[model samples]
Target: MDVVKYLQRAGYTTVQKSFYAKIAEWESWYIGNVRKFHRYRIYNGKSYVSCRRLGMGMAKKLSEDIADLLLNEKVQITIQDSSTHEFVTQVLNDNNFWVMGNDYQERKAYTGTVAYIPYLDAVRVSENGEIVDGGTVRINYVSAEDIYPLSWSNGYISECAFVFYKTVETKLYAQIQIHKLQNDQYVIENHVVECTNGAGREVPSEKWKDLKDFSGLSEWVETGASERQFVVDRLNIVNNYSKDNPMGIAIFANSIDILQGLDTIYDSYINEFVLGKKRIFVAPELLYTDPLGNPAFDPNDVTFYQLPEDTLKDGGKPITEIDMNLRADAHEKGINDNLNFLSVKCGFGQNHYRFDNGSVQTATQIISENSDMFRALKKHEIVLQSVLEELIRIIARLGQKMNIPTDPDSKMVIDFDDSIIEDKQAERSTDRTDMSMGILRHEEYRAKWYGETLEEARKNLPEQNQVIE
Candidate 1:
């Protein structure tokens, strides 16, 4: 989709479309639809070439694994206010944020950036035309290719536009939502243009008549709040693609060559089995013939082939079995070596992935706190933590607008899943020992292990007499 052109037509200026086009390239690799290569082979003394797709699919796996590591069901987001926390939890559950949120993370990992936009749904109005309720907050997850920065400074995107598509029957339309700062307040503009080609290309000015004035939505909305209603999340990496670019590059963007190498090695390993199967060559006289004189062998036996009649006369064996050597060991080693290189390049420590016995296995060993994977996870969580906090704040603000008695200023705490990197059991044992040695306080231990605030842990501590029991 030519999102930039269409957005411009909607009166919203944005970054060049080529930036998003680059994101599309990363998306292709993430889905394993990389550039096709020609495979040449010789059959019947004639050379043939065929286009083949790389079947490793490691790029998708890398994104999925990193996303899972960053955000999973085990991760928790806490809001201090009971009412606001309950409301946000209910909203997240309603939206299946646990599942879809991880998917969004995967998209963010591969596409470099993603946005979470909170919009009200099923709004209610009073007799005086005042909003009685701001309605439920629904989230729209936009990936990199659809995100256009309208205004940004110092690597921060202050105003942006998100492009979405809706298809009515067979006709497609582009829904451009622009979030811009007007008079220090965020204003949202919505425009819908008919995509005559169904590809979101720029529609000619003469064809503006086909544009929808409004997509069953308000033409523009003054959010009444200074803060944005959307949260942008991205991997913690420098945008080497463009130093001034506000967007981030994919986690594996710097390691595309390694990814291609991994796929190439894996493809070769797979093909080895197909091309190295044993074969039996039988002399022509030893082969049976059907009624029509067609050479015949056991129908179920595909490994045998009839050889030329002059084979035996030329001092060749009448029947012979050719067992070609399969370099399974060598191929496995090559794949594993490349996987290690890829793992290190993508921020997972070396040996994080292993290809053994035709199966891929993730390293299950506990990672030290100082390990690269741990540091990378923490770096990523820095951005995600703020994103989740902002999303909660948006939900709270929307609830307040609806007169839902929400505290938008409530403090939020995000606890990311670290079980994959930390050895929880061992850490708990160490903490226990520290507590016994007077190096750690009991309340601190409880606060850490019970996922409670220090005040809560101190208040909930048992009395001295009760501890005797």
Candidate 2:
């Protein structure tokens, strides 16, 4: 769908549409539909060619790996207020935030940008436009192609439009939700239009009944909150494609050539077995037809071929075997080399991945803090941390608007998983040694190891003079 056309038709400003074309290209690569070249072959002095669309599916693999490293079930997000934390957790669980959040990270890794928009669902507004009762906050995940930056500053998108496509009875429609700032308050505008022939035209709201009843939605909403209700998350890479572009570029955007090379090598490796199969040339006189006109030999056996009459005129043998040498080792080495290059170019460092047994395997050894992979993970966490914190705050605000007991200003603590980069058992051993030597306090060690506050650890400590070893 031409989302930009719909955004423009809805009177919303948008970034250059050309950038989304690049997003589509990246999406194609992620899905392994890239067509780099074609293959031609000569059989029986006749030349034939066909398009070759092969890939290693490395784009998606890299993105998924990044997502797993960045945000997993082990990662903890806690709010200072216990009740607030429980409420928020329930809300996130109801929406499957952890799973969908990882998916958002993966999409952001490949498409360069993803958004989280929180809205109040099933709410009632009083005559004074105040939310009276019965509303729940819900999140809408948006990828780059559907995200339209209306206004941004210094890479922060303050005003934006998100396009959502819906199909009803084979007819397509676009709903453009625009978040803009007016009178220091964030105002949301909704537009539903018909998407036809690459253009968008106005449509009546009654055409889509769910638009109003689904979320207590309206054509215009004036949220009393000052902050934008949406959060845009992207990789930490500087966008070199367009200096003025706020959208992020894919993590492997600069390594597309390496990806293509890897796919080419892998494709060649797979074809080696097909082209190097054993073949037998048989003289036509030796292979007679049956009474029913069927060949004496199994016709399904493609390895056997009839030799030309001229070939047998020089006293050639009745049957000759031809076996082409397979370059399996050479092809494997080429593919491994390309995979190493791809790993490094995508910031995973050298030897992070290996191609083995027709599959890609990631190294499982713990990475040191000084390694490139460690640094890259930390760098990405910077942006992700902010994105998640902002999303939480927005959720809290929406919860407050719904009269749910929540503290929008509560302190949020996000503990990302670092077990892959740090040796937890060794660290714990060292801490134990330090505590025995009086270098580290017992409460401090307990708090650090057990994921607790200092006061809580101190309160739960054993008697000072009692050694219960």
Candidate 3:
């Protein structure tokens, strides 16, 4: 296949690269390599103050908060069919799906992820006692940069291209899964994909065609969507981050640049403050000045200045110490302003983070109905609920493919513990009051308390009614 032409037809190379760049920046910030991403400027003949400053870690912290708030505790998932429920439960346990969800959540927070079913071999014995092929179900997670949405309508992706690399024969080979419509039906066509090397040649290994698995019948099932076995998780999308793009921005994308700027300014202030505080001018006669005529002293040594009797004639000491305290106040104020701006822009709300006494501190957690942070968490919770629901459907589809009779329409209940956002006991007290007053049904009250959906709570409602009657 013409890899270049195919990529051109898909027209996501630019978008993919752009997303890759953002991922790179987010990754750098996550791991504390932020200085290079937002380098500090040097001016006024001042050498670049190469001070190692602590990174903001805003992306890392925010992503971690998302995972912890959404999936740190047990995620309540309910399926109707007993057999399918057990099967999916085992699959999730074996795959550590909840733990994997944390990693996936981090990915979604950064650049989004694609969940797809990959074909695998399931072992079966033939009647003649020979081992034979049985289709296996496996869910594979791919990153946004690797999975490109080729076509879309009404904000839904119709076609996609998943490009990845495999090492075969000690050489890197490009592999692509093009999930597109064939004969007016969705089909996944595997290709030995290649891209232009430095020489601009469509270079593919001789083993590329041999590696293609063309034997099995295509796994085809209508998902009521254009794609057969893939779902895109777009979290916190931003516009104009790049040219007309399909990829969603990271959760903290809006504030990363600001955070970067803040990091630089904070570091610069620190370096300047440290230098000023340590600045000791020893009667220019005791120290040497550099070409810039700035007093230079050996930082590694303690210098002693000898004072002549004449120097103290007017009670003026030979040593002059400059107190930069007032100047540092301005820097401190600027740093505080930026930190508050970052906190608010990143959805943590104003004063969530505070700069105090040369260190940063987070404001105490407030569990109040009127709290902005609680509202922010609720907004994100809504999006997270939808994402988890979609993921459960994908897993259920995999279960069906594995011959575990799963009802695709089976309801899934995702109970996120809102205790972190508000006072759970107080809320429960209010719920109990409402229940006693007949303002809320017993099933609804129980569902809220037990973290169950109304339908799941109804299974036990009959017994309670019988006892009460």
List, residue by residue over 420-469, the lDDT tens digit for candidate 3: 66787888899989989989888888776776667767777777452232
**Candidate 2's residue-wise lDDT over 1-469, tens digit each?**
6767656765767777888888988898898886444233435566554557467899999999999999999888867666678778888888899999999899999999999998888777664445666567788999998999999999999999888887755667777888999989898878777776655676665555654422345667778878999999999999988777889999899998898888888888888988899999998887888789987788788989998876678889989999999999998899899988888888899998898888889898888743999889999999999998898888888877767788978876678889888998898899999999999989888767765556556766888723334
- How does candidate 1 score on lDDT? 0.81
lDDT, residue 426, candidate 3: 82
CA RMSD (A), model 1: 4.3
Off by over 4 Å in 1: 9-13, 38-48, 124-132, 198-215, 289-297, 309-316, 432-443, 462-469
Model 3 CA deviation exceeding 4 Å by range: 1-6, 9-37, 40-55, 112-136, 166-170, 183-185, 193-227, 242-244, 277-329, 367-371, 462-469
Q: Which ten residues in a row have the lowest lDDT in candidate 1?
A: 35-44
Against the correct fold, how does model 1 do in TM-score? 0.88
The whole-model lDDT of each prediction reads 0.81, 0.83, 0.62
TM-score of every prediction relative to native? 0.88, 0.89, 0.76
Q: What's model 2's lDDT at 50? A: 57
Query: On residues 17-105, what C-alpha lDDT tens digit does candidate 1 reach at each position?
Result: 77777887798788777644323343555665454744677778989998998889998776667799899999899888999999999
